[model samples]
Target: MSDTFDPDHLRAELLPLSTLQAPSEEAQAYQRFYGLNALGPNGATSSRIGRVEVGGYDIVTQLWVPDQPVGTLVLMHGFYDHVGLYRHVIDWALGLGLAVIACDLPGHG
Candidate 1:
């Protein structure tokens, strides 16, 4: 079997921020100096989101605080995928009284 490559170096090479303009100057690209922005709204949703550093990569873990506090739900995405792509699924999870957690893997959109 082949050896596995360490991705910490590659992750460091990715610039922390982008300069893409948004909505014809009506909006601006989000900037970060230290860590990445999980790209989610505050309030109930944000309260459940947590930063998890695993395998040298940052993963956002979101938990839905249910009225009765049942169990946790973890959602894993495929290659070249971002956690935001599962908005519909997350919403469904909320309706089911289960927590939702997702992340944007490296080199993924």
Candidate 2:
């Protein structure tokens, strides 16, 4: 929130990401029930990740363009959260042809 904080540089540095580890039995079962793939690494994917200028500030975002985007889905993370944490969600949205706009709000830890 302070002018001293450079969002662009921070985004370029340590973008948040969940470490891909062995899934629990429960998680695997849930994935099977929903016809979903394994989480994170083996899940839906997109590489168009970058920062976007919005409201005169650099809002870090990842663009997952679908074959035919039905519409846009803007995902705003809660306090102390970053957009990268929702990579799987964004991947799914891209697969469904929905453009995503995920933003890391100010003061995210």
Pick the TM-score winner.
1
Query: Residues 12-103, candidate 2, lDDT per residue (tens digit)?
Result: 54332232234334433322443332322344433333345656765544444455568988888887776546656866776677877665
- Root-mean-square deviation of candidate 1: 12.2
Candidate 1 local lDDT, 14-85, one digit each (tens): 332222212111111111111122322332332233345668866544344445435666778898776556
RMSD values for the candidates in order, in angstroms, are: 12.2, 11.6
lDDT of prediction 1 = 0.43
Q: What is the clash tally of candidate 2?
A: 1
Off by over 4 Å in 2: 1-47, 54-56
Weakest lDDT window of 10 consecutive positions for candidate 2: 14-23
Residue clash pairs of candidate 2:
80-109
